[model samples]
Target: MSSSLSTVLLIARREYLERVRTKGFLIATLLIPAVMGALTWGSATLASRAKTTSHVAVVASDTVFAHDLKQQLGSSAQDAMQVDLVEPTTASRARLDEQLQDKHSTLAGYLWVTSPATAGALPHFTYKARSAGDISTKTALEDAISAVLLRERLSERGLSHAEIDQLTEKVTVDTSASGNTKAAFIAAYTMFFLMYMVIMLYAMNTARSIIEEKTSRVFEVMLATIKPEQMLAGKILGVGGVGLTQVGIWMGAAYAYSTFGIMASGGHVLIGLTQVLYFIAYFLFAFFLYSSIAAALGAMTNSEQELQQLNMFLVMPLAFCMVMVFAIIREPNSRLAEIVSLIPFCSPLLMNFRLSLTQVPAWQVGLSFVLMTLTIAVILWISARIYRVGILMYGKKPSLPEILRWLKYS
Candidate 1:
């Protein structure tokens, strides 16, 4: 490489090592994964609990209905739930309501079955819970009640208990996707989210670092050795290296988990060698695209607060990508997905989403990378022009017209 390029890389290395050694960087790098892992583990544990200690009351006009509801509720809860069957008298209903309103109420919730006016009409359910946020508990109650009603209906039709059970048996939904759908979904969703977060994270970090140097007058000294474009390149590359390092650590952790059998069988299907390669390619182009814009904006700003006011321009695209996530997952090969995958701002995530959820054609994948790279190049040129003039600027932030004039002058 040329000495100039080597100098740029040297600056990049210095920036990378400097940030990587900081207490804030170390804490964030380690904390993000640790928190994510804890949340994942906690969610799984809560979902897998065999029995919940909920105290639920079931009330119905018919003793049989109340008893059946109670039985179903007990069976469905992961924990040994305390379910009480009560006759639906006005006094009994009022008593339950009072208990629920009590400050020291031990009752979790109550399921009230409104008896149909006629045998032809179906019953209505009114569930009151102390906490409305327990979706799993509510889902379990709904499923249990539905199961009980189905059994009752079948029994009324003269079907035996065996017949009811056999008819109600759950069916497995197999997919043609290369791996287990759950594992694939988890992997795909995680990768897309990580890509978006990493892009925004490093881009913002570049902006903050640039503003820091600009405010502290360090750029005055650095400019003597390097051009504004080189400084921008070095900062982008240096900060980009930190992001890559974090991703590498996470990837290594995933590999270790898979190797030790911590993950389920076919976990490798989610992150094959092909996916990793695509990831690296997309990450590099995405980084350059956003980081270039951040560097230019940072060059113009004198304070971090000033930079924040201009974040909407950068944030909108990321938000748009998030909104497109469901569509890409649902129909990876749809016309909309294909069109979106070619869009420079959305392609990195949408294209990766397609690759993770479904098999994207090699041609489409290559086209996405090509389109994004071209877009990145264009952005870098525009940002470089802006940076060339903007770096020496200080005090008041420039307006849109002033920035446009700077672009022309540069």
Candidate 2:
């Protein structure tokens, strides 16, 4: 092997080992998944234990209307609600109000209905709950009362029970038939955000690593033996490998957990083999692309503060991509999604997100990869020129004009 290639590999190996052997690396690798699992379990547990059962009383002037409304609420309750009929009397209402104020009372609230005295006149409804924020319960009550009123009107018109039942039956759309299942959405959202987070984190770490080495003057000594381009190449490879390794470990654990029926039984989408492969491919493309920019930013800045100030430039594109994520996921084949997914800066995330929701055209996918590769090559070339000069500079950040001149230094 050529001495330059050997030097690059050696530096890469050194960079990889230095990070992987750190206590922080080990702790972070294990702790992130543990924290994520704890959060998932905690959220699921809280949702399962949330107070879904709503206890309420129905009061109306008409006894038959009251009974029908009670029956409607009961049929749609799904065992998560209780309904009771109360006479529409001043005394009864005062007693119900007392129940609502009682801290130990399970009564969520009461619904009061005033049936119109004349035909074609509108009925009035007043729902009083202890908490005004219980929108779900309020919406349920509204729907049930409307159905009851509709049924009563139909009955008055002499419609049979069967006809009323047929008319009022709810129709549900099958999202799975259109390939828009909840599981798929959850999977796409999870994977897209996961990629966003991991890429940003590792790319920033690369920048921070460069800043540390540059500050400590480690590069001045290494420069005697390794070229700037080789050093930059080595750092990207090493840090990226570390990121890939951690991701692989997490994916492996996820796959194993899915096999045990715990995650699978919950109806959560499992990361299939194809998804995993695509994830790795996109991660590499994304990490290298962002890390190249990060490396350039690190080399140009003299201090961590300077790097922080300039960091927004690197973050803005990713943030824009994140803003477009919902739109892309909702309509993967839309013209906007299609166009954005092909932009080199956005492709790594947008394209992968598109893949998760729907099958992207092979040409678009191929073109995206091609564009990203070319962009990476261009950025790496620019970063190498900057790194060659900026690695040894100190005490001040370079201006844009100075940076352009650095690029011209060959």
Candidate 3:
């Protein structure tokens, strides 16, 4: 191997080892996944527990409707809602009001049902609750009331119980897809989000490392020993390696959990093997492209704060691509998706979205890869040119015109 290439590799190893050994890195590496798992489990547990029954009292001027409402509320049995009928007397009203106000009361709510003396009049129903904002309970009550009213109407029209039962019976349609729709969406969203996170994080790490070394005057000593190009190459390699390590950890954990039955059918929801391979390929190309840009921006700025101002330029494209993802999700095979997936800056992420939602022609995928690779190569050359000059000359950050001149002269 050439001495320059060997120097780059050695520096890369140093960078990787230095970062991997940090306490913050280790804690974050383990803690984030744990937190994510906890949140998922907690949410599911809460949803299941939320189905516990509520106690509600029913007051009615019409005893027949009151009895039917009680039966209707308990018909499902699954919800476990308890309903008791009370006459609409003053004592009953006062007692219920007191119970609602009492913090220790077990009553979830109360319903009031009344009918007019006029013939063929419909009953008026009102619900008052201790927790007035509980929309789910309110919705359930509304549906139950509707079902009871429908039954009464059907009976008045001379429909028999057997006919009414057949009419009201539920029928569910079970549809099958070639691939799981929900699984595809979840896998795509997770992978796309992870890709964005990895690229932005490591690329910024490259820029920050450059700024820190430049500020500390370590770049001077390093430059004397090795060329700027080698240093830049090493930084990208080392940080990119770290990102790959994090991804591998996550994927391995997922596989182990899936294998051991820790995850309940959720492992099957992830994208397939071909998409996984595409993800890795896109990640590498995307990382190199962004890191090179970040390196160049870092070279032009003396401090992290200045680098941030220039960082906005890099952020816009990624943000645009993220927004475009929603559109792509809505219409994965649309012309817009296809065009955006071919655009070099947006291809890495947008193409992944396309691949996840629907199958793309092999040629389009191949073309996207080609375009991204070429874009990375071109950007790497330009960034190296800027790094050769920008690191040595530092004062006020250069203006746009000055930066353009640096690109020309360098």
Task: Say which candidate scores most in lDDT.
Answer: 2
Worst 10 residues of 1 by lDDT: 261-270
Among residues 3 or more apart in sequence or in different chains, the pairs in candidate 1 whose N, CA or C atoms overlap within 3 Å are: 50-78, 50-79, 51-78, 51-79, 52-79
Off by over 4 Å in 1: 50-53, 57-71, 76-80, 84-142, 175-187, 254-277, 395-410
How far off is residue 303 in model 1, in Å?
3.2
- Residue lDDT tens for model 2, 308-368: 9999978899999999997886789999999998998898789988887887888998999
Candidate 3, residues 34-149, lDDT tens digits: the string is: 76566446754775576537789999987877888778777654355788889998899899999999999998889888776786787777889998787877877887788888
TM-scores for every candidate against the unseen true structure? 0.80, 0.89, 0.90
User: Candidate 2 lDDT (Cα, whole model)?
Assistant: 0.83
Superposed by TM-score, candidate 1 places the C-alpha of residue 14 at a distance from the truth, in angstroms, of: 1.9
Q: Tell me how far candidate 1 lies from the true structure as C-alpha RMSD in angstroms.
A: 4.0
Cα lDDT, model 3, residue 374: 89
- Top TM-score model: 3
lDDT at 179, model 2 = 44
lDDT of 1 by residue, 153-203 (tens): 899999999998899887767553466677678878888988888889888
- Assess the local accuracy of residue 58 in candidate 1 as a C-alpha lDDT between 0 and 100: 84
Ranked by lDDT, the better of candidates 1 and 2 is 2
